[model samples]
Target: MTAAPVEGELAMVGEVAEQLRDVRRHVDFFDNDVHQARDLAREADSRSLATETTVAGFARWLERLEQSNEALRRETATLRGHHPPDPQRPPRHRCSRYAPPIHLSALGEEAGDTA
Candidate 1:
């Protein structure tokens, strides 16, 4: 009958419409997820850049500190070399004044004593 055929055609059209709606919904959800992922990636990249900059700054600071320390060490060595302790002052000998001096010649008679 013509009525039966028309009903079957209408049913097919309804099923196709439902499928199309489902597909559109899935596409919208996927688009939203992709946008959120991109935003998160951008945020992570920004944080990494900030951290890298901070680390670089710290490295430069450490280098400067090392240079300053080296300069201080050189200054100290220069001062020590230029201004030696006075040697004309009396020596602080722990032994008694009457003790005989220990000559190097007594250690061995092989070489002549230089002292």
Candidate 2:
């Protein structure tokens, strides 16, 4: 009710208001820091997921390449065995003709004549 007491009450209220403002600024700073930390954590997790995906893709690609190489080796072997040499020419025949040569008893017989 008195003027001095009223002035004293107003000053006290002003100090309380200033302290509240400082507390609010500190809370805002802390909230921003928490949000930034969460964002960084999410980014790290996303990077880890991408790296795992890349590694898995590389593993699959390597497996396919190995399968392709094995298939090529099998095809090469099959191609090598597919052709048969001319049996009429004994010198040009393949090594599959490995039997022992039976020399002709008659002197008039030819080299490549099987008859």
Candidate 3:
């Protein structure tokens, strides 16, 4: 009878040990997940910072481009004030497109009148 009770107690203790091992495995899995999440968060933060830095650089470049364009416009206005357009010359369009000046005198007199 004493041996039977001792065997039963050992079996119970074995079951408890197995349960503890299962709990430890679950804890380890969740711990690994937490670490992975932290790593991903850090990576996202790094990318966000890089993107912000690039945008800031672009903003600075755009500001400089606008300033240069404004300066060129002011200089062109000043030049146009100093030199009046000849009545015989064709009027220029307000555009960035460049057209080579056509010498009407080089062409026949009739070709110049075709304009």
Best by lDDT: 3
lDDT of 2 by residue, 7-73 (tens): 9999999999999999999999999999999999999999999999999999999999999997887
Candidate 3 residue runs with Cα over 4 Å from true position: 82-115
Predicted model with the maximum TM-score: 3
Q: What's the CA error at residue 33 for candidate 2, in Å?
A: 1.1
What lDDT, from 0 to 1, does candidate 3 have?
0.88
TM-score of each: 0.61, 0.61, 0.68
Consecutive 10-residue window with the lowest summed lDDT within model 3:
77-86
Q: Ranking by lDDT, best first? A: 3, 1, 2
In angstroms, the error of model 2 at 65 is 1.0
Candidate 1 minimal-lDDT segment of 10 residues: 82-91
Per-candidate total of colliding backbone pairs: 0, 0, 0
Per-residue lDDT of 19-108 in model 3, one digit per residue for the tens? 999999999999999999999999999999999999999999999999999788778868867454466988778563466777878687
Better of 1 and 3 by lDDT: 3
Q: For model 1, how does the per-residue alpha-carbon lDDT over 3-67 read when each residue is reduced to its tens digit?
A: 99999999999999999999999999999999999999999999999999999999999999999
